[model samples]
Target chain A: MLQSIIPLAVDALANAALIFFVAVGLTLVFSVLRILNVAHGSFYSIGAYVAASVGLWIVGAGLPDWLTFPALLLSAAFVAALFGPIVEKTLVSWTYGKSEAVQVLVTFGLFLILEDLQRIVFGIQSVYQDTPMTMLGISEIGGIVYLNYQLLLIGLAGVVLVALRLFITRSRTGRLLAAVVADREVSEALGIDTQRMFMIAFTLGVFLAAIGGAMATPTTGVAPGLGADTMVLAFAVAAIGGLGQVEGAAIASIIVATAKVLAIYFAPSLDAVAPYLVMLAVLLVKPYGLFGSGSTRKI
Target chain B: MAHRTSIKTLLAATALVTSASVAVAQDKPASLDVGVFTFMSGPAAAYGMPGRQGAEVVIDMINAAGGIDGVPISATFVDEGQGAEGVISEYRRLAEEPETDFMIAALSSGNCLALAPIADQMEMPTVGWNCDSHQLFADAEHPYFFRPNGNTIAEFMAYVIYFLDNNPDVERVAIINPDYSFGHDAAEIVKASLAAFKPEVEIVAELFPKLGSSTYQTEVSRLSAARPDVIFSNLWGGDLENFVRQAAPRGLFRQSQAVFALGESSMNNVDMPEGVIVGVLGDGWWRSPDAAELGAPEFAEAYQTKFEKAPVFPAMKMANAFMVMKAGYEKAIEANGGAWPTDEQLTAAMEGMTIDTLTGSMTFRADNDGIVDQVVGMVGSVEGIEGPVLTNMVRYDGDAVLPPEGEDPMAWIASLTPDFIAAMPKPGSYE
Candidate 1:
């Protein structure tokens, strides 16, 4: 049992690490903004595209190979800085106090526009940059060769989860954001800058998604239709984890990834629909998700 | 008396004009419109765009050489990436137009299956350019539809033969293919071929990953755990690129004899390791001696001058389809006594037609399925080319591998024997 379980665990954690990055960001934005940002996955793909471009430029320009590591983070920062505020101010802000359908439709429109824009800027062919992946080298686990870059991704995801926990609890802005989540009207009455909180939360969500996509550049190709695939998978994770629950998102990612890995190992036919099967089963038992309840209407 | 004579004279002139036009047709039109379908956007574009470029370059070459028998060819390229419904609708709309003469139908097997019947229904001479699905003609035969390339059964069996001959002591084999008809059909063929030649071969693992899947970390792990002696995959385009990038560093290729059935297309794009087995699905290798002798090298050079990249197999397949169509028209015209033929005449001409292509000759069987040579090779860094090129090549005769008409393809594969393979050309003998 242990022999079979080791490979499964390693594969699940590695897969979950990639999913957790985008899912948590999507959940975070939904929790704070009271709107499911359909365009969150677009930021993730944009980050991947930018990271691949920068990493390729670094290698082409004769820069130190180690710089590719920082290039990933820098690419994410660039995407978040450019797209976060502008989208939040124009599209996201307009959907405030609107019905869920309206908000979803509007962000869905934004998603379509971003998808076309990516095609125009990046062209139809896939973009790949694996300098970081190759530089980090390889390691063997459970008699299977694994990418050390993959191990790094697992560690990075853990670090992000912890850092997000600390930021939401210890920081001053964190307390304000928490208060707004608790009661937006009362937070405003208590002289908290709710608008600023909204912007900060949305930007943070964008940053998380962009970083996820950037980090994935070393393992996957950045191409058209990647954003939509990521978005659908992220939505599954977000739903399974209970919407707006950061820790829930992390745990849900593991469950979903585990399901997918198990399917690939034992049942290859169910590989594509494995995550959704888990979602269906989880949603059946707990209609509001594992960590969700009827009373958590703060969003 | 004058009115009666006038009526009789008019009747006589009308009858004469009708009878005279039947024997001597009008001159060829100023330009011919071709409906070309391929994926122009999205993930599949990685493969489909090459086919599109080949069409563009071939059309340009044809026009430069004074067009197809003096009629300038104009093409309307349709993006087949937009699902089968849209593809069928586009074909119907284009077929409805009297100006559109022929259709280079599609790059996808699914789209080809959908458009095949429609071609016959509309009396359009359509070629299945890049579609290799055997299922396209399994149940129904389209009079107007034809494929100038080899089918999946022969394509997959060639890989199995090569692998078995090289690794006689192989115990376990694995498969990782995309989750679609093309992928599933190839898997069936490979397994059947294995059972036929080497009954003791064990298929340790089989995985069907979703098309356009970005990551294969888990699939890689599963495959590694299986500890197979050989691994075969037919994943192409960006999916293949992603798999190569992820699996190479983990020593998958080094550990196992990796056989990428469609790897030739991405040999230029990916940093593929030498000694990995790859094939072009047909005799589309531009660098193959046969192709070079047949002027494929010149076509490739002209293609590179126009598209800025050397032609891959998809490009070769599309270009060959154009050649086959042009040959059909010329044959039809010849048969019609120096006059342009109708759609029915072209269909008749394509039936049981044999024509020389850039790669080799394609002879259309009575079933409208063409029998072309299958070429398989291993990646080697040739001194002349900038990137890895196919070496240790073997070209299998299509007639020997292809199932006879009206026979079940799987049963035909299962009947193949080791003695059967021994009589064929060995690897590295093509040169």
Candidate 2:
């Protein structure tokens, strides 16, 4: 019995780690920006493409294997720095103070353009770079061998949660960002350069999404349509976690991942719809989500 | 002004007359237009692109060699990765065009099933290029539709018989397939084959994950936990690549002898570990003993020079379909006394015909299903070959594995026994 359940747990954690990155980014952007940012998933795929390309380049150049690890993080940062402020200022800023439908339509258009751009640049073939995964080696868990990189992913997700908490609570820039999130109109009235806050918050969201994509490349094959799949799942996690709640996103990621894992292990037919089923169930019980409140904003 | 006006009017009238004459010429012309469907994107593209490439080369070769009795052949390629609805819409649109003569459609079985009824409705001569589903023609046969390749029963039966013969002591078995009709049908056939040949063997686990899914981490873990002696799967294209990539790292191959039925299609692109059983669905291995002996090496070299990749099964399937088309055109022309034949004559020519392909021969049975040999083998990294190639091969006679004309396939398999397999060719004996 333990043998059976041990693999299930490991699978759930690995699944949860990937979900946490995208969900956290979506939740983070919604918390500060008050916009859903429907194109957030494009950032994730771009990160994956960049990471795969960079990792492949490093290996091709005969660079040391250890550099591949840092290359993953560097690729994500590069995508964020390049696409974050540009998209946030030009396309995303136009959707501000608009209706929800307008925001969705605009960002959705951006998503379509980005998807086409990815195809043009990377072509239609799948890109895989597993240097980091190979370097991590494998471990036996309950008679089943697993990539040690998978375990490291679970640990890294936890560290991100803690580090984000510390940064938001302790740092000066983090406090200003929080101040902007708390009351943007008042903060702007009080001479807080709210434009910089929006730029920083949006860039951070892109970085988070990109990091998720980069980290996942070692285990999964990066292909077309990945952006759309990631976007839908991230939306489900955000909705189940009350949209803009950070801790709620973390907990909701596990719930969604667990539901999908259970469906795969037991009812294989329902694997595709399992996460959405949980989302529907959670929304039915709590209309405002588990952590959401009526008037006050909290993370 | 009067001279210019008269000149413009004459030019317009002349243009209208020429356009009308051109339209009439095309209406009475004898050429055939076919819509060849295959995947051209994603990991499946790795396999599907070869089919498209083969079609291009074959059409060019056929046209140059006097195309179908001097009526030039034309093809419109459609990508099947756009889902079923788009494929059906494209089929309808193409069928509506007056110039379209036939359809060499569909690399996917799901798309084939979706387009079958539409073919009947449109009354288009549609040929399934690589469907391989036994159920497509099981219920009702469309007069206009045909498959000149072996079905799932013939393909999967070959795998089971080969494995059972190779490992007579095998006991436990497991299955992992794409969660669709193709996957489920293959599992059923494997189960039926095992029951007929080795009833004592236990099926420990059966898994079916969604098609085109990017990850197989959980499924791999499940297979590892099951600890079966042999694992059979029909997951092809991107799903197959992803499975191999993930499962190899986890030592899934070390635990059990894996059987990937459509494995040969990915030999060039993926680094499949040695000793895993893989096969081209039919006798489509470009490097097979028959192919090597019959001048397939020069053709393969030409293909590699043209496409920068070796020809996989889909390429061979497409090339064979072109050969079938060529045979039809040649037969029609011969019957018409050396003149371009009409659509009816071409269709008549294709009925009840056999043609020699690059690898082997394909005979269109009475029901329009093709009887072609089933080739199964294992991945062997041979010297001088740039990538892995299928070795230890056994080519099962197409007629031996196929069900009798108008008989139920499942019932046919149920009536078989171990003695039946003993009568068939042994593993690695094809040479």
Candidate whose TM-score is highest: 1
| Per-residue lDDT over A155-180 for candidate 1, one digit per residue giving the tens place of the 0 to 100 score | 99999999998988999998788889
Give the per-residue lDDT of model 1 (tens digit) for B1-431. 99999989999998898867754574577788999999988778888999999998888888899887888889999998778889999999999998889999899999999989899888899999999899888889899999998899989999999988878899899999999998999999998998999889999999999999999999999889998999999999999999999999999998899999989999888888899999999999999988988879888999989878899999999999999999998898998887987778888998999988999989999899999999999999878678789999999999888898889999888777889888888889987
Question: RMSD of each candidate?
Answer: 2.1, 6.2
Q: DockQ (C-alpha) of model 1?
A: 0.90
Chain B alone vs. reference chain B, TM-score for every model: 0.95, 0.91
List A-chain TM-scores for all predictions: 0.98, 0.97
**TM-score: model 1 vs. ground truth:** 0.97
Docking class of 1: high
TM accuracy, model 2: 0.93
Worst 10-residue stretch by lDDT in candidate 2 chain B? B20-29
TM-score of each: 0.97, 0.93
Instruction: Give candidate 1's whole-model lDDT.
Output: 0.91
Docking class of 2: medium
10 residues in a row with least lDDT, candidate 1 chain A: A290-299
